[model samples]
Target: MARVSQEHLDARRRQILDGAAVCFARNGFHATSMQDVLKEVDLSAGAVYRYFSGKDALIAAIVGEVLDQVHEGFEEGARSTPPPPPDALLASVLSRVLATKESVTVDGRPAFPRLIVQVWTETLRNDELAAVLREGYGVVQRTWARIVEAYQDAGMMRPDVTPDHVARTMMASAMGFLAQQALFGPAPVEVLRDGLRGLMSVPDRGAGSQSG
Candidate 1:
């Protein structure tokens, strides 16, 4: 028998991960069984183990994939604009997230929100998972902080605010809103936009303050 190429192995791993995501989205992390994932991929139990040692590993991969996609989306959004202001750059990042929420689904459900919730819960119980989550969140915070510092340099943000503080606050606000929307229904984007504008201290093209 010939050894499988790295490309082939990666493709197979991705296929398994996709199927695992569907199962996880539908039945959740703890409730989902390896058998369910195997059935989704139409693979034997042994085949599943060849790629992922167990459910915990698979869950980590799923969460890692989601974070990677988000990072890619933000990078693409930032690159699409040549040299926008910090506020505009941050808005571009937010737009990509909103677009992702609209486009990506698993098991006929929005994956990011459910995935985030599941990962947050898992992080509480699993140290390895928590470290992965912390790294992803650190990337997010640092990215936002850099953008905020740029905005401050451009004189777009108030002098009193620190970039790190603003970045943390922005992340907290976005996550909080997403949690609310997931618990209830779709949140009004305009409301979120207005709140963000206020938080970022985006200068008005016209003369006055806008009410939220």
Candidate 2:
């Protein structure tokens, strides 16, 4: 009985988050009222409040869910047995980012990316949301930096540069592309891959040596 109740509770939370995502994606976060979210969920006021304290709480939960999905994809890529070569790892990461499963929709339009943009917009307005965004981005930054370090250690990435530099460049590029795609639905993933291939390429350490 207790276990069943727990399962039902978890499902209800996800339902609320899903409803909130749809609402925020449509109206933008600051403009979206709790009443709007309630309308989206079609649930009793008390029931919804039980899961989230208020609008901020619900938005925080939605942000948490998005960051979790991003982290999961990173973990899945980082799991290649024997570890993937640098190019392979970067390729797989880009492939995973462009995965269609990330797109949730309302009324046939993609909502997830829009929701993320809305969340970012709110982060500047709400201190709590800013903290949450910072924490989540910190996790992502460290994860990518570790992967970059690994590539550098293997001599599969350029030397003379810190892992932070490589990680920041790749992360910034990927995120910028996401923001662009969210607003404009720009070019395919191949364009990004092609662009990054040279930036991430392994430098020949012995290129300047006199080999006679």
Candidate that would win on lDDT: 2
Question: lDDT for each of the candidates?
Answer: 0.70, 0.73
**Candidate 1: where are CA atoms >4 Å away?**
1-10, 72-91, 94-107, 186-191, 198-212
lDDT of 2 by residue, 1-212 (tens): 44658889997887888888888888887788999988988998999999899988888888887677666666665554334654455556656644633455766766766777788788777999899889887887777777766666677565767877766776677777668867886456666776677655657678679586
Using TM-score, give the best candidate's number. 2
lDDT tens readout by residue for model 1, 43-144: 898888998998899988877766776566555534432335544554555566667555346645565666566667777889999999889878877776
